[model samples]
Target: MTPDDLADSELPMLSAAQATHLRALAAPHYREGHQYSLESLAHTCSRAPEEHWPDLVAAHFDRLRQASQGDESAEELLRGVHARLLPVDSVPSELLGSLRYARVVADGLVFAYALDGPTSVRLLTDRDVERAGLQALGEAARANLMRVPVRHEEVGVEGGARLRSVYGDSPFVAGQALFLAEVAWKVVGERLPDAGALVVVPTRHNLVYHPIADGSVVDAVNSLAAYALGAHEDGPGALSPRVYWWHRGSLTSLTVIDHETLTFSLQPPPHLLGLMKGLVHLDRAGRLATRAAAEPAGLEELMRGAAESMDRLVQDPATLADAFRSLVSLAHARCAYDPDVAHIDTWDAWATATRLGSALFTGAPAQECHLGEDLVWQLPAFPAEPPADARGWLDALYLAIVCRQTDRIGRLCRVPSETLRQDDSVDEYVLHWIDTLRAYFSDGPSMDDVVEKLVATIETSGRDGVTHAPTEFVNAIDYQPAALFHRLIARDHDTFAKALAEAVAEHGGYWDGSAAPRARVALGPLAMASLAYDYGFPVDPAQPCLPAHLLNRQRLEEFS
Candidate 1:
């Protein structure tokens, strides 16, 4: 007889209403390649005849609905079910074992290909985990797995049995170790002997389960190592290597594997545990591990504070500048007082880039009086005082410049630009400026001469000239300050002069009852030219320089 014609005891003990609701939920999934249904779940649930199968199915649907609404605390849901339903008995075997289908975070469902025999299992990779109520669970599991301090240098397919043979499913590598082990057991545990299985774990890459062929964890590890090194004739003398194992379901380390020594350690080393714990917090912050690796203790909290402060003051340019200045100053003071602070040099570099970049692209002051703020931030940790260690200071300056330049390039890329008249054309001269600055910062024989030239350029500007009137100018706030827009204006002063006139004419003669805004607009090209020149880029006065054009016009307009 068909599934519908089965006896009442063989089918799900659901009321007609419950069966109808399940069919409605399972209908859409059935069309989308999901093979599970009330009938199929009943058939699989019958295998564990002692369990209350209907209650288990109801609980699964309840959890799925909650998970779909963004509550993905699966463990909590399971605990609640255990406490409420069938409280006298332990958790049902149907809940832990085969349930016809297991739904992951997205829209995919894992199905039991065989429930009673070899217990083949399969999960759909094509379905969307986010829509299927498994995305958060998947992400959390993936994040936890990434923090596992397992390193793999090489990955080769050798004599390891196909994962499909054991589970009728290909190897799956994403998600937490515990979750993966659960999937493995649900898929192939019935075929696996009761003595337990030997799992070959190649670091964080992939896991292959070998049905209980070896007796103990030590023997299992040794057998895997021998298989890994069996191809000695293919290369130089292949040596025995350390590998990991999954025994009964828990991850364990197998280290110090040689001809004489096979040390089986149940716990990961202390240092690795510390690093992994730090990584979990960093992952939550959406940051890379470079800074966190050295100083993982409070970096996430510090970054959160900085982000919150920035969000509040971003609209108020002056307030933002003040806050950034304070942060840079504090960081510099800390570094100077204690050079041994974890990754302080890197932190200083980041702070300096932020400070100088904000001043150039935003409207922060950069006077010689305030140059100490920048200098102090750039100073590297030297073993002795200067004169005897002058080179150290210079090295710090070089590194700081590189950091600043890279930061500026990234900022320019993110900002929008309306100045490019042609899409295909680029401003090549800006690239020349970057290369020129790099040369000046290099350790060549003419480095001293180049340094002198750069110092003279900044000194000639004088403290007032370098950081004076521009601080009062209104930031355009429209575009990210990029070289393309600046070069477009500087490509030909006459064309730019006409463009400025056109902009002013379009905006009703650039008079908002204030010369400050109009002057800032008119002298925008000049400000860009000044930045280039200050950074040691050569600008010919006779050429079509926007600053020179603006200067001559300012005298005529009597705006200065």
Candidate 2:
């Protein structure tokens, strides 16, 4: 570990590309959080000057949100939480503008995992990270977090040749997280030092489906992540660890993050949002004037009117032509100052009113169901490379989960009585017969065995006898709006991390990490990007820069 050892040391000097990663890992020197680095970043072709690499890019985007504070020019749009746009031009638009809204305005997200081994499986939450505490979990995590120092595993199918394009001082996960967090904080602190409050919170939630119940084993590695987010020196921004995981047959553990006004206004497109408000006006007009006298006739007449009104609103086709322009105008008015609505004043109000009316009229009966947008949940995307150190991934997952909950909320005007409230706890939901199920799923050698093991996992975990948790965590596999949800949003694996936890706690997976095929660092996001492009899901087109080679996971298009 000494300089003299650099000459005689087996530790290899980083390759040119690796050096670039290293520089990024080391970029926090000018920020308050990081100490100085010995290696010079100036001449390496690895470093970008500090100005171009200004601290947290999130702040800049957020600043744009603040600037649009009083844009009262657009009245109808500021009226409600969502729009009521439908894609009835005979077919859907190739690139959806909706997904882009979720991608950018996503308040927070969570991605969790249920790791399985020969012994047991356990839940890993991304939301409850405590940085220092996790950092103190000894060498394994330290080594993994600073993985930039080591060579990446070869993942190409053809041969074992290493991927030399992406390199780092240590592993890209933690090292980059620390760098970004550090620099981002300093920059924000500098920009808004006196007027606003600044604090960083890491959410705790688990992603990953597993049935393992061995607390001793689970706590050992999982606590590392918990500590990282939980143990900050001082509160910086509003964040906390959030996570998702799978337990038995359920998806559990969702996270929530504080949403800035701009991001809050970007979700819930018009397709499913055209219900409420339009009816409010009808209510005032005493439109349901003959409910007592006509009963079904009155209801039927109301439906006919609502439909005709909606038809006129769209059928004429002269209302609004560009959807994106409408959304942009809406985002500014809503998020900049974060005010409450006194009247249906914004441009989006017309749409929200229609949605409100539709929903209110449709739900006159008990236990009734109304259709909404199919929700596609996602796990967290690691800011740095993966396998993300548990702490970093958990934090990202926590954010992702919060975003999912926001999505869930967007689909609901008011949560049903059965839905898990923000007050639910993990212990009360625990399945009792977890041990038997965990043992049952341990040896399935084939896919068939994996299925049997999974079924056993569900049965055994459910034996805990806990009644009615509601559709708190509905399975995308069986949800009613599954197709449409997939059309708009795709699952981030971490979104369901908790779904497998109880099952794993009761009965573990049949295989271990060593048995499964290895994954490429590029695997998850690459697949996501391909899906995004193919289906035309909306994503923020903003390009994120790193210390390394230009381009961001291909999410940001390359500049040729």
Top candidate by lDDT = 1
The TM-score leader among the candidates is 1
TM-score of candidate 2 on Cα atoms, chains taken together? 0.16
Worst 10 residues of 2 by lDDT: 513-522
Q: Each candidate's lDDT (Cα)?
A: 0.31, 0.24
> lDDT by residue for model 2 over 1-560, one digit each (tens)?
54433421111233444445445644543344223222222223224444543343334333433432222222211221111111112111332231222121112322212222222222222221122222332233333333323222222212111111112331122122222222223322222111111111231111111111111112222332343245321112112333222222122223333445411111212211111122222222222111111122222343334344434434432221121122212322232222222122221322233222222212211111111132111111112112211111212222122122223122232222123222222112221112222222234345454344344434432324222221221111112112222222434333322322222221111111111111001112222233333444443323111101111222121111
Q: How many residue pairs clash in all the candidates, one count each?
A: 8, 146
> Which window of ten consecutive residues has the lowest lDDT sum in model 1?
80-89
Every model's TM-score: 0.20, 0.16
Score residue 84 of candidate 2 by CA lDDT. 12
